[model samples]
Target: MSYERHFEYPLSASSRLTGSLALGDLETGQRCYREGRLSVDGGRSLPISLTHSPATERLMYGGEVECIEHLRTSLREMGVELPGSGGRWLPGPLLLGSERTRVTQAGVLDCMRSPAFEEALANRQEGEVVVLPVLREGMKYGLQEAVCDVLGAHCDEVVVDAHHVPDESVPYLGRRMELSVFKDADLTLAQREKVKVAILGDSVASGTVIIGLIEVIKQRFPNVERIELVAPLAAVYGLARIAAFGNEAVPLRAHVFESLLNALPPEYYFSPFFPEEEMHMAKRAYSNYRDWWGVDKAGKPIAETACAGYGWSEAFFNPRKQIAMIDEQLRERHGMGLAEVLGRY
Candidate 1:
């Protein structure tokens, strides 16, 4: 792995794929990342750029990834090690790498443009690594640019337009927006020579769009060796969807390397959920949630809500519309005004 360093995920399901057990429908793989804590520390950094929110950093490298607390209190704690695995993940495929330093729009772009990152992409040595960033959002945080900067003329890019919104089944916590469909695809790698690897980089919340895009990719660009998700802050629930897809359908070899995947609160899908253990990080935002939401009766703030991120659909949705949507959600759930809520933050 080209990552300068990688945090360990002892409970990742990828660690259990060796025996052909057909690991069916892993329940979003939520509890696996953390050792025991169900919530995480995060909130109130403020948005630094149109592309990302400081709320995001709290989950990535900003906060301590402590959910991985349980385990091998005994010699049995040392999980299986694949025969020749080289990456942090014990599975044969290497973990997706990122410098994972302080999160910033500039830093994201700069890192991708760095010589080290370029070398990382080049070293995918197994075969051609097609960069398939989901449309609109994929273009953010320098994800799409990374492909261009790294590969330049050799950049084989596929921009996919697959978005996930509230589904009819339940607008609560984001129901499955069935990503098994696609609206559009640009520069798609259709029916080409066997491209063994594909990289998907995004903030994976609801895995709807990804599963849909992957379906399209496998259909159009069939017979690939592996699909790697380069998600910055992926939800365990979302990753679970991908796992389910791989387990049931085409049997794809996907590698996801997220340091944490606490329970995804249905409210914001990503946040308002707070881990009491995380008071040390994003203390301001944490306080904001506790003070404003008044938290649940248990005194727990909505998990993942502190700073689940704002203007997430900036690529496709305008700010005005985005705020309006937030306003509606705020009123429906909290019975609070948008200005009242936003102002508190």
Candidate 2:
């Protein structure tokens, strides 16, 4: 028997960035730019020269893969090993970029160039899942006709098209149109009153937003017990560090080196590259470090609580490990008289 599965997901911010570039769609590109989702600065022009050719298309995809592969290989060669190896674990860049490349190579590009695909894409409502099946594998074993069975276990609610719908017993996943799902969901009065925030802003405006949020929260809810601030890919190192030290005077800069090692795996703690294994590793390392350092008399890990509300649970996620790895690689490359490797575009 043969089985077919379609892995559908919303177009991520990065994917939209690449897609806009490949399609030479200025409107999409400008939207991404205004939203601060495009990482590479095109600056008054699209970074890529718009050319319609197989080679040019391949190069566009391959360029991103090459850059990520270089970083991964360089970091590995410098002895910055990832945990639980299946060779080297896939970093976010490689995973995301390669998937997009595969999808494009699988004929999504042709669809994208068509007016039908463009119209469908443009008119797609928010929260709509875009199905992009890049590969189809053959197997003798038969399977049920359900999304969960085809895709394996997933935590999020899975919905299928009418054709793929299993049976009347299993209801279709309902779409929630509200901006805040929490508002529609059942919550206790106490839970409703709690202060939880997810902040989104550009570098220049983020600090102002944070300050403004805190002031508003304090004024609005005087008795709020816990305040949680979540900022994705924002610089929280200073905030994390301050939380770590608390009332105690910050230790010497030398301590930062050790702290940096503990924070390596989850690069999101420091940089905005989507986290992979690094986060789990960082959490484990911090737990071990806390154990070794011993807890305070309150039976909690001293300084560990500082990063409680920040992404990491222990210390500020700094780029110490990344910096250290790059420095080591550069030194090794230079000593080998292969310094030119660093300039390999």
Query: Best candidate, lDDT-wise?
Result: 1
Cα-based lDDT at residue 33, candidate 2? 11
Candidate 1: regions farther than 4 A off: 1-122, 125-127, 148-153, 163-191, 247-307, 314-316, 342-345
Predicted candidate 2 versus true structure: per-residue lDDT over 99-204, tens digit per residue? 3334223222221233322332343232221121100110100111111232232212111111111233321211111111111134334433442211111111
lDDT of 1 by residue, 169-271 (tens): 5322234434432432443444234565666656666566666666666776566555655554444444544554322333332222223234333332543
Q: Which candidate has the highest TM-score of all? A: 1
Total backbone collisions, model 1? 22
C-alpha TM-score for every candidate: 0.50, 0.20
- Predictions in order: lDDT: 0.39, 0.24
lDDT of 1 at 94: 11
Mark the regions of model 2 whose C-alpha exceeds 4 Å error after superposition: 1-88, 95-208, 230-345
The C-alpha RMSD of each candidate to the native structure, in angstroms, is: 17.0, 24.3
- Estimate candidate 2's alpha-carbon lDDT, on a 0 to 1 scale: 0.24
TM value for model 1: 0.50
